[model samples]
Target: MPDHQYLLTLKHILDGLGRKGGLEDNLNGLLATMARELGYVRCFLAITDTEDEDLKLSLSYSPSKADSVSYAPGRGVVGQVFENGETVVVQRISDNPNFLNLAFGRTEEEMARLSFICTPIVSHSRGKPEVVGVLSADLVMLPKDELEGHRSFLEAVASAIAHQVAILQEELAVQKHLLNQGMAGLPEAQPPKNFVASSKAMRLVLRQARQVSPSRATVLLRGESGTGKELLAEAIHAGSPRAERPLIKLNCAALPAELVESELFGHQKGAFTGAYQNKRGLFEVAHQGTLFLDEIGELSLDAQAKVLRAIQEKEITRVGGEMPIAVDVRLICATHQPLEDRIAQGKFREDLYYRINVFPVFIPSLRERREDILPLAEFFLEEFSSEYDKHIRRISTPAIELLSMYHWPGNVRELQNCVERAVLVCEEEVIRTYHLPPTLQTAESSSTEISLSFGEAVGKFEQELLVDALKKSRGNMLQAARDLRVSYRIVNYKVKKYGIDVKRFVNSKSRKR
Candidate 1:
């Protein structure tokens, strides 16, 4: 009877795929049917992300909201199936050490009594079978032989859905290519001015931002400090229909707790001791525009309640006045810390979290997107050089290597500052290794062997010293020699060896006159 039921379930899923509706809809319906007929309480179909190759939860038969959860190759049982192109059957989920419950977050009590089975969804379109995804389901614990039979049944189901998965992959690949081409070919994609997205990780983030930009949905930019959350917020607002309206920004952590309410909502005369005149808050000032709240996790609980009210009601009340003022503002929030942890600690409101997380975009860290480092460095170098009236042309190859190897803890903001400083200290057309901060010289920070040789290091230091002395002496080699307590011949030799132009400094001084 069990074998007959398994055969019937497979026939139903294959037949349903032939019915009307889109590919995704048919696949979802197939999953639901499998779960119901196979006596499983939950089922999930994870498809491979075309870009990162991670297993992304595509469809499920559970009630939980679809999250941004993904599993790298060989991360868990589901990942293992996708990684090795094999099937996994856990007679008891709790006893399997490799079972990492990253998705669905089943409780330990429930896991103790459940059996899990996962099989790769293999497509044979290209002559050979290729694993395109994984089909996983959780069922009540049964006898060992029964669990094995269920695993074999799931493998058949995976085989049946392989054709639909192949078509889905092709459609997705075409859509992704078109989206990237559209972004690359159009100027509208560059609304976030001066933003550099050279890495695949960053490009993925840009795609997400573009998809959500045209709507009124609230956007939550989650990442570490200095990762350019404000720039992303600008991109979203600039792409939205609210581009012409004012884009108001406020850092929740920058202001004191006492002034947060006044800053967010407006205050009337005598609202507080210093509230001498009527002040329009950010919400009111951003009417029909976009309001970006940075470091939202730092907001006080009381302030959180008021902010939630403003978001939920689409209006705000003056601190001293009772009448509510209506405002039509799109909100974009950013936070370095995780709001879920904050909620667990009673620091953030769960309700507000849901309201703001309508569209969450995770910006990868600088170290994670190292491919973008050189482009961003060149950008900042050009910007700072023009600002400071320097003629720095390019960064040396050794300098580029150092920049790529070091881990940027402060993220893009830190990298920008680093490039700016290097430009300030650079005396010639090319920025060299010594121009970077000392922190980057350390092996641990650079994550490699010492980049500069002993003689190369000495030469860089000597060159920098020569440039400083020459600047003070106004191109007088004799005076520069005196400043360094060295002979004029030695100074001239060092200057010539480093290709330092003394007449440029003289011309610069003459121009200053």
Candidate 2:
């Protein structure tokens, strides 16, 4: 038997779970609502890791206070409830030996004075109820006799959470099945193909992408055109929890201004002149997945406003519809255009810029990460060779030098096109400089005294000197530094500064042996 306040809190949580948002949002809402209403000092939800079956702290009211704690099944009170699928109530947490108190960082005195309650969150699996997680709370002032009542109330909340999880899981399964069946207009939710990141700069970018992938953080990728911003977005999606769902991509600059809103937020039947039937928007299609917007700086101010609202509210209103539809999407935006300049010129909304800029990943241009150029070129050569049915065994040294010397203005995409063209033109076993585009040859010759500041010129010279030293020493940093007459520390600093990956040279030297 639950009290009036407990029932009201349970109802609020159950109702909040139905509104459109991410599972994390709904779970946080439940925790916050319950904590506020029940006077809980702390509340936490721990879900069993799919791979390891260990209890992972998924959500907490005081997130910073919650450490990255994990528990084996039946290890702690929370774990016991999850493993045994039972309710646990400790009148005083310190008296219970099973209470590990791993996350809260509470003192023994504080633990002894507080009451603890944990409930198992169970969901149906193959028509059988299975425990999926544990919901636990800390109460500072609740009487010992009231522990049973609080336990019952928490059981209700856990049930509500389990129900939501079941719904989301079912939806995800259906979406995956539909995608596998090759549903029309839906992008395949395939993992991103392996991308090369041999350069330190590119590796750092990949690290950042991996770090932010697990969380539902809005990522803004800033880079020059053809720098693989879209590729990085796909990698983020592949590494995310929503990898099984659709990853819808749209080039904002490619769409006409009149259709931007309609494309993003679908219109109802007869909503406009061309509204032939009710259609789902990209947001809806990308639910539980990712929406990658390339050239986002091209969005109109009106469109930016609408997008901002959708991001803020996790809901969207169709172009002509008044009702708001819930959307659960991880937004990954990319742009070659300078958003700050657009904001200064009133072409982009400042608020929207700030919102999307939560996790900004700057991808270095090909010129900046020159060490990756040869690897990327080789990769492209192999890919194009396979595609064109050519047995181009290797790129000639002269051709490699030419590829390295020419400043790739169009970056990776330009390099890929160049390699494809070279593959198509070359008739022999190897690709030579002659097989390369005439523009590259002319560009290399004409750019002898390339316009560069004194510092840039010195840096380039240092990088070239370091590369030559590393080559002479067969990628031995200590030997290279000794050959260059510099300390190992200085050489190491210079290598990192130039975004050089010494491992590639080291492996090359090893392969020679």
Candidate 3:
């Protein structure tokens, strides 16, 4: 407490505040000041992790290795403070539940916990305080009574660190925003627009896609629903050597069991009640090209045997026909259902599974490729903007953050739909949080599905979509009309039907000029 000593401590505190590196790097000098001021073994600062959702070491201090310490939060006294979210003051280590009288490791101590305490770090986000991290420390260096003072000082210091961390996060979010803008600015791919994918996992899938696209070998694409299995099929057929040849696709699961055979292999005239003509099957039309069978797992056993024969022999027998018809076509199939499990259940054929699964590729779900979320969102913005003919720019920072945290159970497909909906409904120069679908606006608070009467849900959906077009049109009843894929008169009619307050969303020109 002497003037000269206090002056030196003040000098170090000022220096510690400006150090720009890890939490420990900035706090080390302060810990030294605390040690010198209190005549104790060490002073430490600990930060909790946003990950373990528990306090982990952000920084610490001690007599010998105070400059470098390691103790995972929830491990000892430090961990106890984190787990309980309370301060500790154990003058004797042997007497307390938290006491590890036999301390070994970094603390490696017979050192008593004369006084230890911790506090949560609540940081500011958008002017709102959030507990982004936690703070803790040991007052092994301070007087027993000033434990209260140490607590106060720790609280202030944690707040300061929290503020800095919040500011850094905001800046990062902004930089990411600009980077995404750059990515979105790239020219669109040639055709089949908006199949958004950019990540190591997806990149590898594209690799396999390229390899199988050129050959007549059967390709089986597998993944949970919404992982873009159909997109892969389309890409394969579009890029194959048979690009000029017809590429036919059929959804086996969507057809009735009685209709699947005629649907895939075609039928002779009057083969069945609905079969009035000699229709050409996918295999025949896709000769020298590709045939994609989606939800192939749903094929009946009889259908499976025929499909297997077609794949094996490169020929097909029309329904009610005796002779086989030769065809050369690449086969690509996909299913969300587990084929192995189905095979075990006798719902799928084991032999047929091996044929189409010759070159198997699994598309990872969205959560696994989280890094691609924003990228995909931005891609959809441009795609939908062009489709809707809106000269839109970007999405707001808050909206983008909301998107990043969203759990897209429906994967990229869901994201595409959300963004397209946002684009069509957004009236602002840049898409704001409000432009996002109700599912997103409500997602932050609840994970439950949005339920409504079928009619009500459809009405709400139609309203948001039309509102987006009105925004893009800038009140030019004509432009808004074109953007919605409806005639000007029809748009005007729906504008009334949806009860959109057109005046509220029109751009300046639409409003005044």
Say which candidate scores most in TM-score: 1
lDDT of 2 at 411: 90
Clashing pairs in 3: 47-58, 48-55, 48-56, 62-66, 74-79, 424-468, 425-468
| Best-to-worst ranking by lDDT | 1, 2, 3
List runs of model 2 lying over 4 Å from the truth: 1-194, 443-446, 449-513
Where model 3 places Cα greater than 4 Å from the true spot, the runs are 1-193, 443-513
lDDT of 2 by residue, 1-513 (tens): 248988888888889887866667888888898889888988988876655678778789953378888989888888788788989888888888878879978888888788988888898743789877788898874676788788888887877678565444443444444455454233332324437665657766875775677678999999999999988999888877788889999999999998988889888989989898988889888988899999999988899998999899999989878899999989999999899999999899999999999999999899899878898888888888888888777786657877888788899999989999999999866677779998777645426444567698567667866876786577899999898788999999999999998877765542110
Q: List the residue pairs that clash in candidate 2.
A: none
lDDT of 2 at 507: 53
Q: What are the per-model C-alpha RMSD values against the true structure?
A: 20.1, 20.7, 16.4
Whole-model Cα lDDT of every candidate shown, in order:
0.85, 0.81, 0.68
lDDT of 1 at 452: 68
Candidate 1 C-alpha lDDT tens digits along 1-513: 278998898889889987856789999898789878877888888887778888778788875555658988988888888989999889989999999988787889989999999999998766788888998989999988888888898888888788778667655664566577554332233435479876667867877776777678999999999989999999988877788899999999999998899999989999889888999999999999999999999999999999899889999998898999998999999999989999999989999999999999999999999988999998898899889999877787768888999889999999999998898888766788888999887898767787468999789779877876787678999999998899999999999999999987774442210
Tens-digit lDDT string for candidate 3 (184-293): 33221122565655565776676566555656678889898898888888777776667778878898989999889987888998777877789887789888888889
